[model samples]
Target: MSAQETVALVLAQAPVPPQDPGGQGEDFGKSSPLGLVLLIVFAIAVVFLIRSMTKHLKKLPVVFDEEKANAAAPAHVKRAEAEAAKRAEDSEATETPEPEETSSKPSQAKTD
Candidate 1:
């Protein structure tokens, strides 16, 4: 109802951060072989994940593009091939002309 009450309510509603020393927080009494084994397995998994990531990262270029980096190529070879094909088709279309009217039908028709 009052500013002081509202401030107190907001302060109470706000979540408090953990004041613990950021330790495991739980006192599992002591360690066990299963926990150690699980930890070692997870550690091995993390190492493998890091190695795999490094391998793939080394294969990738500094400036990578998914659409252009297909099959790890620098440029789009398919696009270049398509452009070459299109140019060849255009040149073929322009290089050849229609057949001429070799017959004397036009001259005969004119004379008639």
Candidate 2:
């Protein structure tokens, strides 16, 4: 029950042995070929996707100002442009009816 007796009892027990050291060998990078192959394949796929995206993006304007300019044109200018386009598409050069204006609202519930 005394402190000195407790210390002596604790120190009298047998001690556990330390574990053996692990065997060291070649580096991890030199030990595996599959890891290197996977790394190369992933790098190539990333490069290919980036190139494909760049090619697709080049088909459009660098600045999209032309579309906004067309939308902001005066009504008369828009009509003239549409008529010119229609004339260019005519088969026999005969007169063609004008395209009707499309409404954004539904026709039936407009009165309500």
Query: What is the overall TM-score of model 2 with all chains considered together?
Result: 0.36
The C-alpha lDDT values of all candidates are 0.83, 0.82
Pairs of colliding residues, candidate 1: none
Model 1 spans with C-alpha error above 4 angstroms: 1-28, 65-112
**Model 2 segments more than 4 A misplaced:** 1-31, 66-112
TM-score quality measure for candidate 1: 0.36
Candidate 2, 55-76: lDDT as tens digits: 9999766677988879878999
Best by lDDT: 1
lDDT of 1 at 26: 79
Task: Estimate the Cα RMSD of every predicted model relative to the unseen true structure.
Answer: 16.9, 14.6
User: lDDT by residue for model 1 over 53-79, one digit each (tens)?
Assistant: 999989867886776657655457778
**Model 2 clashing-pair count:** 0
